[model samples]
Target: MESSAPPSPELRLDNLRSLKVLGKGGMGTVFLVHDALADPSARSPFALKVLDKSSINSHHTNLDADRRARWEIQVLARLCHPFLPSLLGTVESDQLLGWAVPYCPGGDLHVLLHRQVDRVFSPPVIRFYLAEILCALDHLHSIGIAYRDLKPENVLIQQSGHVTLTDFDLSHKLKPKSIRTAISSAPAQDNFPETRSKNRRNLTRWFPAASENKKGLKKAKSARVSPVSRRKLSFSNGEKSNSFVGTEEYVAPEVVRGDGHEFAVDWWALGILAYEMLYGTTPFKGSNRKETFRNVLLKTPEFIGKRTVLTDLIERLLEKDPTKRLGYVRGACEIREHEFFRGVRWDLLTEVVRPPFIPPREDGGDLTASGKDIADYLCSLKSPPPFPASPSSEYQRNVSYGEF
Candidate 1:
């Protein structure tokens, strides 16, 4: 993937202006752009995301590259939600280099989380954010689209605390036949032949061994001399290869096992995020990639203290058995109704109510200054009293198993 190209002075299109850089990624760059057609006095702003032409042009045989972009545009155009970034318009210039999308000023949830890791949100506040995400997921799923990517970075939070889901580049439109094929595929492997046996061992940790008798003694005996001794087992003989996808820390077991994942995968990632927010760290982290993956496969996450309704909810969400996972059997409605969300009224969450925590502001009293000042102040709290000469290295490493 290529980084987004710097704004081109010669390629300006109609109704688009002032290309201020928002962020850059391997695929493209997002900019804070203005809509020339909108009322100049209007208070709202939009973000224009430009996909790198190099990436789009590099894929010679796959029409999917083009199709994915078009699909995202169509999906965004059809969706109308308080928690979704509205698509003002899309354009392909005469130069034929790139595609552009609207700008979102609220920034992303990942940025906010890093700035306020020390702050603990109230239960209602957490529920409010989670409910909004669920609502967005429901809408996407209803329209036959699966948001393959769901991370704090992909979620945007406005100054008003209203969160909007963005980044449809990785989303896929679900076709009935394809869905059937995915469901019918087999478990995935750990890449190395030596690790194949290790992967199978880990699988048994999460799921019960297939045996006629329920007794543990019988299962232990069966494991020693089972007829099916091969480490790698394919789910479907002719199914397509499993593509490496998703952030490593947030990827689901089903996805890792190559058992054909679905919308429920998003719920698993949400569980990880919720845990991180509550504890100030991820539950399954390790020093290296292999160690982290092994932890995800075999180890159980530790809960800090007294069991609360929220702890129960987190346990359900992080259940190792995909069949018993929070979103799998119970669905989103049931999740929203869990005791942890006791007093939440989903209908009123989008009405510009104040959020639980507001990042501190500067004495200058400018809204723009508030966000930056707060970020700066948070950095100042670090012990040892040192600021890095360069950007943090945390974002440089790959955290997900998925290939970009």
Candidate 2:
């Protein structure tokens, strides 16, 4: 029997009052909105992502962006995992295309990272966040979707301190490989063997006492390429995507080389995320985009402190060769087994009543009179601000609406 499509969005724009601007981007603006008709004491508010269809069509030459907008809706419709967002409904009109999902009051991982005293998370905190993120990604990959974009901004904290991944525009669906094929075939590589040290520099032996110059010089040599660069290709599951997509810092080496990428690319991003949570910045970041790409292609991540299993996990995930990267063959299973997550009780994550950080409930208010006043005040702006393009905007990922 043919599967029926999910129900259309029942949310009415007129009944929804904008409480605050959450984010805006090329695709559209996300608003923290409340349903005026709902119970005054009930927490019926949600985040509404409104896409100006006309604006998107005008800005981009192709319909790829439009398709991406819809792709997110489709991906959310069937997702029921605790660590993933649920699509409440969608809205469409002559000029707009939008959808609503449960509002996450805890904000995103980026904001949480900055909240730390040193702008970095301790190992325990990193392990907590990464474990939830790993579960979320495992669920995504199981559904045959490759989340091309996996950055701090995309991981939202829930009321309980658990995480829910958002922004699915860059995600891609593929035909899943059969268990037989997956078990029999070795992971593919881009002309590079699992052990890339033979062709590149051998930095595994370098301890904390190693000279900095030697490490830097060797890293610089590994990144040098011929005049010609690898060509980009489109991607599909079990197949490769050639599209040049993803956040620059979080993008995998294969993505930069235009060498087609898959689920493993997300693992590479995970490595970067771990590094940033520990160090307050991406490991391969450079002064400029060009330099950054060069660093990603050739540089080995330098650890400031001593060697630990956490650093080891990052090294394995950041392997320049995708085929050799952690999680390449067994996916999240391989990562979950790493020493870094030695004692994580994966099945009981959601039941943890006291997580590392639980968002304040006051931040998520019901339909109070004050909330109404703020909505009216916001609507009364001389030039009502265009919907906020956040996580989507180049520099607005960190922006948040506190109280209003």
Residue 31 lDDT in candidate 1: 47
lDDT of 2: 0.69
Estimate, for each residue in 107-174, the C-alpha lDDT of model 2 and write its tens digit. Answer: 78886776655667656667777888887888777777788889988898877677889998888775
What TM-score should be assigned to candidate 2?
Answer: 0.77
Candidate 1 regions with alpha-carbon error over 4 angstroms: 1-12, 36-44, 54-57, 60-67, 94-102, 117-120, 175-242, 357-404
lDDT of 2 at 350: 56
lDDT of 1: 0.51
Candidate 1 lDDT tens digits, 94-143: 22223444443445666555544353333334555676777787666555
Stretches of candidate 2 exceeding 4 Å from the true structure: 1-5, 40-42, 54-62, 178-237, 363-404
